[model samples]
Target: MSDQHLLLLSILTPFAGAIGIVLLRQRPNLREAVTLLSATLVCIIVVTIFMRFDNAGLMAVDIAEPLPGLKIRFEIESLGMLFALVASMLWLITSIYAIGYMRQHKEKNQTRFYAMFAIAIGSTLGIAFAGNLITLFLWYELLTISTYPLVAHAGNKKARHGARTYLGILLGTSIGLLLLAILITYNVAGTLDFQQGGILAGKLDPAWSGLLYALFIFGIGKAAVMPFHRWLPAAMVAPTPVSALLHAVAVVKAGVFTVLKVTIYIFGTDFITSSGANDWLIWFAGATILLASLIAMIQDNLKMRLAYSTISQLSYIVLGALLATNTSLLGAALHISMHAFAKITLFFAAGAILVAAHKTDISDMGGLGRAMPITFGAFLIGSLSIIGLPPFGGMWSKWYLGMGMVETGQWLLLSVLLASSLLNIAYLLPIPARAFFGKAPDGTTHHRIKEAPPSCLVAMTITSLACVLLFFYPDPFYELAMDIGGTK
Candidate 1:
């Protein structure tokens, strides 16, 4: 198939699968089969599209021109390709993990869960391939709407509250700030296309650029910069698979991806640097990084800690964007991929612990590693990666971020990076260490703990190994980042 056809297929496959899943509602096994099949097919299509991006140079296919000069389009560029590849590939992995998770946990409304999961993946692909601001906003809202059912899947009071927060913050930000920003850009530039340098360059007065920058940055709330981050932690009332989708695969990735996209494609790195429009935002991103990590250090629940950790890690990408240097932009893009693998592995292990030992709180999980050694081992690997240690994918992104800081002579931000790593170690490592060394909370001889089901183990193991493999074979992701950053 042509690249354009592949792009359309990558987006539509999951939507079609959602309908198919609903059709097979009464047939649980067959319904799951549809989910896995659709996910696998979408991954393959997205990989092919990435290959096309390299072979034929970046391509943009116009799907519709709804109004005069108002086009709805799909584009394949280095950054979009990378984001789409991450989302699609993880969709397949998450499907496998979810099957084991939903079955083992005995979740109700299984059909609805699978269908929404499919729709969410489709929306992510739409965001990934969006050619302009309007296209992206449409899919961005769709992503929020699609995942609402997943967040509220339990239909309980807590779940509904989470879903409301999820909707309120995301919709509120997009409509309130993002849409207004888009209108201001259109009024000034008259075009919303993702241009090479930026559409707003030399068009908007420098006096007002800072305000516009603020609108775009905060508008993309999935980046979870503080004050808009409450929804993320609240959404943890969702099942682990949905949590994996939010953190690793779709929602949060889309958030940071939009940040990078707007910074590079809408604001232009050079324009941002020349005007110093990003100066104040840089400090805000730094504060989000350190403060979120501090909060992560105190959470007793594993998922909540990871959620806070996600908020912290996301700020790293946001900080990289605000630095407005080539190296830092590269770091921001690489963090999207690196953090996805590492965070997903951590979440997968958290789910495995839940399924196997029925434990959620760190205080209750003493010596869990003794029984579920593999799960804890995977957790350790993920923790080390997130800490940005040697021989892990996370290290490389942080290295480039540090280089960007040095190049820009921002020593204070470098200190923020270092302190955040220390905090990462403080919160993440102790869990495994306690699991391996400390005693159970009951203070009695325990024998019930065991490894998670086969599927969960398989999924977590793959992502954990990916964390290590990325350190050695960082070429593909690095090349994509360099392409997006326009680096040598």
Candidate 2:
């Protein structure tokens, strides 16, 4: 198939599969099989685009004309390709993990969960390949709505509360900030098409440009920058797979991708730097990176710690965008991919711990490594990756972020980055530390513990290995990111 056709399929295939699964819902095995197969298919299509994409040429398509001068369209540009790859690849891994998790826990309404997840994946694909602001906004809202069912899947008070928070923040921001930002763009730029070097760079004066930047940043709350971050941790009450979708696969990444896109496409880096419009964003992002890390350090719950870590890690990308340097932007792009593997592996391990041991507190995980070596080992690998250590994917992004700091001559940012790395270690290392080195909790009866389900272990192990593999073979992402900043 042509590239654009493949792109369209990548976005739609999941929805189509959801329909198929629903039709076969009477047979749980077949329904789940459809989910797994469809998730795999989407990943294959996304990888196809990445493998075949001409980094030199923009992958564009005008799906249809919508108005006198507006249209519905999509494209796989550099930033979009990174998001599409991460989302698509993780869908399969999360699907495998989800099947194990949901079945083992005897979760109800699983059909609806699978269907909503499929639709959510479909919407994420739309965001990744979106060619214009209109297309992205449409898919972004769709993503919000589709994930609601998953958020509320438990049909309990806590699940409902999380669903409300999840829907409220995303909907509120999109309606209040995101839509206004797009409307402003349409009026000022006269077209909402994404372009190289941005369409708003010189269109408006500094005063107006700063307001526009603010609108876009707060509008895309999925990036979870500080005040907008509560939704992420609140939404953690959902299944582990849903948390994976939020943190690694779709939701948060989409938010940051939109910010990155606006940085490069809406407000050209040169324009942003010259106008000094995004200068405040640096401190805002730095504060988030540090503050979230601090919060992570204090979280006793395993998922909560990872959630806060995701919050902090996401801001690292945002800081890179605000820095407006080639290395920083490249690091931001690479972080999207690297963090997905690392964070999802951690979450997978967390879910496994909960399932096998019925434990969530880090303090309760003492000596788990002996019984659940694979899960704990995977967690350790994931920790190394997040700590930005050698032979792990996190190192590359950290290296470039450090270089971005130096390139921009932001000495203070270097301190923030280093401190954040230490914080990453502080929170992530302890899980494995306690698992391997510490003894079981007093009177906890260590003999009763064993590894989680084989399926959970299998899925987590694969993702952890992926963390190490990406460190050695990040050329795919590196080439795409290098293409982004023209550094290569």
Candidate 3:
């Protein structure tokens, strides 16, 4: 079979799974089986594509010309292939995790949750393989719509409010600013196809490029740069699997991925750097990174704190894109995979804690780790990785990002990176620290809480181990990043 056909199949597999899930709605076991089977199939397909990946873009398929000179297309590039691989493989892991979580929690609308989860993965694949801005925008909006149901799974007032904000911000930004940016870009360049160097370099005037850059960055609200980041914490009312999907696997990754995509393929890194079009982005991202970390330190709710931590971590990617140096772009690319593994491990641990201890607040988690040591241990690994410490995947990305800053002589940004890591420790380490070392409240001894279900433990442990594996085997990601910059 051709790669193009495989590309199409990867996108369709999840949608087909969603249908199968609905058809087997009465049989919860069968419905979950469909999710697992489809996830496995999609992972295999994406991995095959990754193995076949080449510097010359493969699987290029122009499916339609929606308007004169405007084609809707799909293709796999180094960066997009990396994202597709991450999202596709994690879909399988998250499905395993979700099955355990939903069954243990006895969540309502389990079928809907599974179905929407499948649809969201389909949209994510579309985003990853999108060959141009129009194809990307369509998939981007579809992802937002598909996940709204998952966000509001509880059917409560809080869930509804969160879903509304999620939809409102994502849609408003894309339609209002992102769409406008696309239109202006097409008008100026006469095309939307993503090119290796960039399609906008000579066509766009330097004087107005900054405004265009603002539209693209803020318009991709999923990046969670401040003023537009409230939707992230607001959506924490969602179940833990959905939180994992939003933060690590799909939503937030899409946002920062798009920012990096625009920087390298839409605007051309050299052009943005030389034109100073990215000046505002660098400052905004640094502020977002530090401020979000500061706010994360104050949150007592475990998931809420992780949500804020996601906001801060995402800014690192945006800052990398704005830096526009080869090393920084490489950092941005590596972080996409490193942070995914680490953050998902953290969220999976959070869910496991919720399932086993019935605890949500950090203050209440003291000594809980004594009983659920595995969950807390995984949480510790994830925290250290997020802190960008040694022997973890996250350190390499931060190292490249700091080196990027040095190459560009942006010591202020480098300082922000250092300070954010300290803040990452402040907010993230305390959870596991309290779980293991701190005393429980009221000075009372509580009954031993067991670890989460086997499925949850398997998922969290796999991700935690992956964080370590990435540190040792960082070459694959580094080579892919190098491919993106034509440095290979």
Which segments of model 3 are wrong by more than 4 Å?
A: none
Candidate numbers sorted by lDDT from highest down: 3, 1, 2
Off by over 4 Å in 2: none
Q: Give the TM-score of candidate 1.
A: 0.99
lDDT of 1 by residue, 7-30 (tens): 999999999999999999999999
Best of the two (2, 3) by lDDT = 3
Predictions in order: lDDT? 0.91, 0.88, 0.91
Tens-digit lDDT track of model 3 for 173-278: 9999999999999999999989878999988999889999999999999999987998899888889999997666699999999998999999998889878998
Kindly give the number of clashing pairs for every candidate.
0, 2, 0
lDDT of 1: 0.91
Which 10 residues in a row give candidate 3 its minimum summed lDDT? 442-451
Model 1 clash pairs? none
